[model samples]
Target: MNKLLVAEQLVVGWDAPVTRPVSFHLERGEILALTGPNGAGKSTLLAALAGQGRIFSGTLFRAAGARLALQTQGLPPVAGLPLSGAELLALTGASAQGLPPWLAACLPLRLDRLSGGQRQYLSLWSVLASPAELVFLDEPGNNLDRAGRAHLQGALRARANAGAAILLVSHDPELLPHCDRHLMLEPIS
Candidate 1:
């Protein structure tokens, strides 16, 4: 299978290196889980793979047309927004026509009124709707209950089965079963 992403001798951190040199390959139609302690550079590695952070002493190769999807921790207040949920989804190119009943119910609510899980779902849906070969998710399981996590997992599987490579950074072990491979980041001394 073709490689979707490759990081060679990567050093990730804020100012200086927080982790050892990391190397890995993510193949197409596969999911790789990035796990580590709180300060172990998990997010930093994701950011580097997504091109959001600088690569201190290595190279990252991303397949052409790759897309990075990130679900941040908190849901920022979206009060006073004129657009409804459906409209927002539309703006992100997400197809809201066939969403599940529960998800569809959230279409008319504003982002501010939606629960944290709902916001994360919408964000993920937006990324899924986009035309990209690779997807990166950071802390995807945060704020999601069991059912919500199940729903997200199904969506992720569907995407992977459809040939999109996925890189997920999460703390929840429940997500491990969905991944094809795992890479644990170690903090640099």
Candidate 2:
């Protein structure tokens, strides 16, 4: 199928289903927000879509030959690794132009040596700049400053403008406004 992605009454979780069956769809050039209180299975839903976690029920459809990338919560554990920002992006087929100027200039610096925000921004930009037709971003605004947040808004716009589909999980009010729509999950008791 040529569809971007479609979720029908999806229920996802780690040990057991954490979300109260929810449904949402995303198409190219569209940005959707996955929002809710903690423990609402927001991350799990992304995990299910990426075919990582257990899908207790419902179904997920991704277009055949579609590219996928998931920016999971928090920084990836790269401590003690000798990888550089530029090298990581190159490995992922992303470009440095997509990152903020400060981060872009730090291309040669070791990833483990960069500040938290720098690392977070680089990690996010890598996925955003990749050729991923479907991108899942989980709590992407964790350590971003006001300036970094602005860049994030621009990134979202840039991603949509480039004909990519984005499904983001964020509590940052600053980022929420940029989303075209949202799927709010209610916490299950």
- TM-score of model 2 vs. true structure: 0.95
Candidate 1 wrongly placed segments (more than 4 Å): none
Q: For model 2, how does the per-residue alpha-carbon lDDT over 1-189 read when each residue is reduced to its tens digit?
A: 335999898888878888888888898898999999998888888888898988899988888888999999878788999999988898889877767788888899999999998998998888888878998899888899889999899988898888889999999998998999988999888
Q: Rate the local accuracy (lDDT) of all candidates.
A: 0.76, 0.88
Shift of residue 32 alpha carbon in model 1, Å: 0.5
Evaluated at residue 113, the lDDT of candidate 1 is 78
Residue 174 shift from truth in candidate 2, angstroms = 0.6
lDDT of 1 by residue, 1-189 (tens): 489888899887667777789999988889899888888888887776666666788887877766665544555456666656787777756677446678789888877678777876776677665566777778778777788788778777878888888888888878878888889988775
| Candidate 2: residue pairs that collide | none
What alpha-carbon RMSD in Å does predicted model 2 have with respect to the real structure?
A: 1.3
Best by TM-score: 2
Lowest lDDT sum, 10 consecutive residues, model 1, at 68-77
